[model samples]
Target chain A: MADFEPTIVAFCCHYCAYGAADLAGSMRLEYPTNIRVIRLPCTGKITPVFLLRAFEKGADGVYVAGCLEGDCHFIQGNLVAKPRVNYTKKLIQEVGLEPERLEMFNMSAAMGPRFAEVAREFTERIKNLGPSPLNKKNRNKTDKAA
Target chain B: MVIGERKPFDEIMRMAEGLKKIMVLGCGGCVTVCLTGGHDEVRVLSSQLRMARDKAGNPIEIIEKTIERQCDPEYVDQVESIVPEVDAVFSMACGAGVQFMAEKYTGKPVYPSLNTTFVGGSKKEGYYVERCQTCGECKLYYTGGICPIARCSKSLLNGPCGGSTKGKCEIDPDVDCAWQLIIDRLKSLGMMDRYEDIMPANDWRTNRDGGPRKMIREDFQR
Candidate 1:
């Protein structure tokens, strides 16, 4: 378990979080390598199903990063995402997983440092929670076969 | 226009106990219009149930399908081939759809995922309030188009009960005094004279107080 490498998924909005990731790359900011970013047009495109699907498919931790509050490029897209993320938290808890495994964050496109910091913070959080039970179960099955 | 809401998550899991593979059937009718049970909802519920089962280490195989309308036999017939594959049918439709699916497949178990609520229209998105009880009789002409049988807590046809207070029912502050709404509507329509006529006692024989009711269109029948 000490050697476990958590697989994280970050649903980044193209206008902000994705651009921030691009800037993070340009600035050469160091963030954890656990994140696998899936760029979305806007966080408003997110539904509870998408987050639920991530955990079902074995993502150890998932976070949606959109534009800061009222600064959404498409007006209130970021505002629309907060509740869906919160609702998905309850859903994961219902599935017997920690609600902390999923989250939502907001930042402008220029906040590359914040993006890196968020990635590192979320990665560290998931690492402490350990591998998701779904993934762990798969590992156990593989070990049994071996 | 029947309204419904999903049963609690815990109740759903409890009802699904010991069931392995089951079909989650959704109706694209009233339940769908109300955002209760529809194609999107079926997927959401199926996904949730699968994750819950997986987390419990008791994984379940769920088949998801949404029919045009489960109340009709032709639509229910669409699942005849797939029905045999699952242990039971989890209907996300209202009670009628659930019973129809159950009746169509006598060998398989059928369960309702939504509590069949009332016949009503949405006040807005995701908000539903009962408007009719389908008491087999309607007196909207005298009641100013409001249904006392449904809107009134006591289903009082004559007027507001003693419990009415300042336009709200005593049952809850949120519940509007149905009779008050009726009286105001009547006054606005210049139909205040109708309010003076005391409504006669309703006939129980026309409602559920009678036995289960059925109607047949003789001309449409073979």
Candidate 2:
């Protein structure tokens, strides 16, 4: 349990978070290796189904990172995503998972340091929470079947 | 269009507890437009069920299908061959669609995955509000298109009832008084004079009180 490695899925908008990640790499800012980022055209493209799918597929934590409020390239994409992400958080909590396991963040394209900071913060949060209960249950079932 | 919402995940899981295989049927009609039951919804629900079942050591198989409209016999018949292949059907359509499927195929267990909520329209993207009660008779012409039967907390016709205040209903401050909206619309349309005409009590026979109603068109009958 002390050395458990959690798998975190981050949906990043192309215009901001994705670019920030690239900038973070160029700047050699260190972030968690456990985070797997999926780039989307915009944060508005992030749906509740996508977030749920990540957990179903054994992700310990999931987050959507988009442009800062009122700064979406699509004008209101991040604004639309804000409520959807909050709704997904409530939904996951209802399904027995901790609402903290899912989150939403906003950052500008040039915020490489901020991107890395978020990655570290989110990774630490998930690490303290440990692996998702859904993942643990699946592992136990597989072990029993074997 | 009729609006519906998905049933709680726990209830759905309980219904499929003993089943090894099931078909999740999605409706492409009102349910699709409302974002509850549709092709994408069927896929999402199927995946979730599969994951939950897998974690329970039961590993159930889910078949996902969406028909044009579940209330129509033609669309319901299209899934005949697939129906027999699964142990049960989890219908994501409205109540009418679920009953239609059950009536078409007897003996097989059909469970509703959604609770049929209301006859409503989208107030905006992703927001829906009840607008009609399907009372066989429509009085929209007299009420400036606002439906008292559906919007009024007490379903009070000819009212800005004693409970109305500041254009809001007493039932909930957030809800607007239907009669207030009707009056406002009438005032804007210069039809305020019509408001003076008293409305008679609604005919209960034209509503569900008449018991399972149906409309038959003699001209379209084959």
Candidate 3:
């Protein structure tokens, strides 16, 4: 609904979010196409460095979708990822970025509708916030060209 | 091995002022094994420093490098090429490494990002315990291989005072009495009679009390 099209990265768990994405396609549940998903073995493998790197590389919104609590295929993978998300949120905020740009969600592989719902909700949120201030370099060049 | 922790980010930024270029030196020895000054930490600190500098309107160029051992001159000599280009160096190694870097680069200022703790060993995977004082004295044979200099709260050599209650030291409720341990170990070895000999006070002159201790082998010098 707005000119700002947020560049979103979803670090999806291989066993859950990845499967759920496939289910969404199978069910024909349509969502925003701007989201790029990176499948990881488990959410625990997602370090704070990797999350910061995503933000540094022009990601307007970053989300970590892991298995439900106590339901992770790798014991406490989701649990480990939960605190790291909170830490990275604080770090991003300290660096003058909106903390809400980073989000962590838990869902099962069977929740195809929920995945689509998340995509829509997150896209709307980012659209309301407008473009990331860090991407001003690209915006300025585009504005001058126009 | 000495155990230490990284300084706060704000403090590190304050110490890094006026430097347009920085070289973050990381050690792959004790600090690396302790997870404070390893390659991973070097990258994180470099990124954070760069971001902080940029945010402060003073973008700094930083080069991240790590060595196998910072205390060894050979390992530190590897930075000869980059040391000349950087305005300053921020060492994440122990105090010895920081001093070594300062000595190596006479003109450039070298700052330390970590507080040097003491010669210790890990109690657990992530926990460390001070075990030696490097007092230039070896009395472990009589004390059942435990250094009273570090283990004892007061560095007492003969025995623990009445402050020891139920195997715990009075200084720290969580710490076990070093003298109690010495007695137990000696008893187990059927050598409790060794404790009867009146041990004299430790000679402080043998340590840093003599102003920077040093040792050399005359036979090997040639």
Candidate 4:
């Protein structure tokens, strides 16, 4: 049996990634159910605080999937999202978590299979990393002492 | 906008580490426009600090407050009522605000949570690029409004250096060549002929070189 299912939060941009997810559903592509997707108007709107809030609320993994660069409905939205993701990764590292837990991907609405593929790949990666040390279901308060 | 970025979380945490309770002072002036040390950033920084502390088993108490302008003594004076209750303060303002907080609450240790980056202007949303050095004098009229002190990598006063490739800086590949931008702006404004004249090298004495600069406008003075 799988050791534990990671609770991953995927912030999908409405223009592309969210549409791609809908396409995945229509195509009947199977992927890990661990991911909980939140649709955002644009990936650029996702701030550093949202990423921190995700960890604070006990998400095992966080993913931001946006439209391909230059394809964002709102021009340069993906570009803005890129630096923010990089900055937040540093914050996560500073808080004693592996930076790899936070990931960003670029995909188009037509890439339904790619969405499922990314989900499965991220799920497997998190599994190998084990449950988030912050996941309260699998850990106690003393685990946070550093 | 006073463009700046928050200090590394761990580094900031270390600065405010031993305090049981601390006040976070946010600036509502330049930093507010830059989205660095404004009221919203203060709230988020305080929350993040609290969480980091809790995770580390430290569990600190943070009180967030914003002043209209931390650099002004009139605004900072308001903190006196709240200052006595906290063990320390984490100033989220610029270098000026941080120093003002330190001066206002003399006995308490004041820490800076943001790195004072530069005097700059916002480009498109969320993109702030340096635009001025606050030199005691203004020469923007001669350069068609672009500031050589801040934008140019070398702060070239006259024209684009020979090293400019395409329209990018030679020192850093990612930076747009400032001189190139100035020329474009001047040409668009039909002021290209004016840019042909060479500018004298900057006189550092008039800048902060003579020491921290100050100005008194008699016209605006009481």
Candidate 5:
């Protein structure tokens, strides 16, 4: 279990969270290397289907990082994303996955340290939760075929 | 539009438990507008089922299709070519759509994935409230455009029984008393005198008591 490295997918809004990630790199901030961020035009573009697809395609954990509340570049994109992320959390739970595996975070472009902090925290959470059950089964199938 | 809700996930899974391959049929009519049995829901449910089955190591192949209107034979006929290819069909439409699919493809098992809840319109986004009972009789004129038969807990024709208090139904305090709404609307319309007119015994035969009602237009028939 010590060697277990969970694969995490983070859907980051272009206006804030994505820029914060880039800034984190420029500032020499160190975050876990487990997460792969997919930049979105807005957090509003992150639908429940995308979240579920991420899990189905073997993401151990997923999160949406959007603009700070009332600071969305498109006015209410982050506001709308809040409820959608919450709903998808419930949906993943219904699919027999832990609701904690999916989450939503808010921050502005200047918060590079906060972005790194979130990445490390979420990666730690996923490591504790271990690999997704779907991923395990898929791996077992491939191993047998091999 | 008619309102429908998805059945519980476990219950739906059980319906297709042993099947290897199945078709998830979605409706594009009232159920689509209500967000229960539409193309989007079909994709969501299909993806969820695939993951669930994959996790269990008993993966099942799913075929997805959404017809224009499941209640119409012309639309259901569109799936005739694909019907025989699958072992069973999990219909996400209302009861009428499920039955129509079953009738069209006899010998093939058709299961309903949604429960036909009611004939109503959205009170707001994602919120639906019943407004009609399809009693085969139109009584909206007598009730100030509200249907007490559907909204009233007891479905009483001469309503606002002892159960009504302060415009709320006794059955559920949150529900507005149908008769109260009727009286209020009539008062605003200056037709309160119409309430004094007695309503005779309802003809139950016109409703479900008539058993499997149907309408046939001789002029429309070829």
Candidate 6:
């Protein structure tokens, strides 16, 4: 488990989490390279299919990072995505995977350090769980893309 | 609308043990409206099944296609060209759709992905409740549009049946007493006289007791 470098997918809202990641880079914040960020217009657009497909595609961990509560770019995109995240967690559990493999986090666009912190934290969580049973034959392919 | 809920993934996987290739047929009817077996659901369920099969060292190739309505032969025929390519069919529609698929392709094994729940609709976004029993009888004019047959626990004709309390059914506190609703509705409409008339016994012959029934439109057929 210590040597396992998990392929963690972070689905981020453009107005907040994605901007936070950019800020994190500008700040030169050091986070694990294992985390891959997928920028979305809003977390509310995140569907159960997207989360499930991530697991089916062999993601060790998947998390949706959106705007802080009541601070959404589109009024209540974060709140809209909350129940969907919870619903997808149950779905992944149905497939014999740990529900902890998927998570949702909220942060403002200004929180660069929090973005990097979340990256490291989720990576550590996935590392503890080891590689997903459905891990691709060539796991390192995603390493370069991120 | 016919409400359908997907069966457990394990049960579906168990039935899919020997399948190599399949077509996930989705219905664009009641199941779609109910948010169960639609286009997106076919993909989701197919993806899940593919992953589970892959993990178990048995890979399955899935061809996904959703039709207008699985209950109609016109739509079911749309899959004719591709259906022959797959060994079996994994239907994501209701039991009727699944059975229709089975009947159409007697050679291929057809599997149902959902358990057909009831004839119902939802006032709530995600919660659906039954509203009809299809008893081949119409009595809504007298019951103030509230159906005691489907809503009542006992399906009594002269209900309230000494079990209703606090305007709720004795079976479940959450269930509203159908007869109580009828009484209240009739009273509000100044038509309490409708309830005063003693109801006669229902003819079981008109119900499913008469066996499988059909409607023939002689003009349309000709």
DockQ of 6: 0.42
Worst 10 residues of 1 chain A by lDDT: A137-146
Q: For model 5, what is the alpha-carbon lDDT of residue A60?
A: 91
TM-score of each: 0.93, 0.90, 0.82, 0.71, 0.94, 0.95
For residues B149-179, what per-residue lDDT tens digits would candidate 2 score against the true structure? 8888888778988999999999899999999
lDDT of 2 by residue, A1-146 (tens): 67988899999999999999999999999999989999999999988778877887778999999999989999999998989899888767656679899999999999999999999999999999987876454544333322
Q: Distance from true position, residue A69, model 3, in Å? A: 5.0
lDDT (Cα, tens digit) per residue for candidate 6, span B1-222: 999999998899888888888898999999999989999889788877776776666677788889999988888888888888998899989998998888898888999999999899988877899998878887888899999788888988887888899999888999999999999999999999999887898876767899977778898995
What are the lDDT scores of the predictions, listed in order? Answer: 0.89, 0.89, 0.84, 0.85, 0.89, 0.87
- For all the predictions, what are the DockQ values? 0.39, 0.29, 0.22, 0.16, 0.43, 0.42
lDDT of 6 at B156: 84
How are the candidates ranked when ordered by DockQ, highest leading? 5, 6, 1, 2, 3, 4
Q: How displaced is residue B105 in candidate 4, in Å?
A: 3.1
lDDT of 5 at B179: 95
TM-score of chain B of each: 0.97, 0.98, 0.94, 0.92, 0.98, 0.96
Model 1 reaches an interface RMSD of 4.9
Worst 10 residues of 6 chain A by lDDT: A137-146
List the candidate numbers ranked by TM-score, top first. 6, 5, 1, 2, 3, 4
DockQ of 1: 0.39
**After superposing candidate 1, which stretches have Cα over 4 Å from the reference?**
A135-146
How well does candidate 3 score on lDDT at residue A43? Answer: 99
Chain A TM-score per model, please list them.
0.92, 0.92, 0.92, 0.91, 0.92, 0.91
lDDT of 2 at B153: 89
Model 2 chain B scores worst on lDDT over the 10 consecutive residues at B50-59
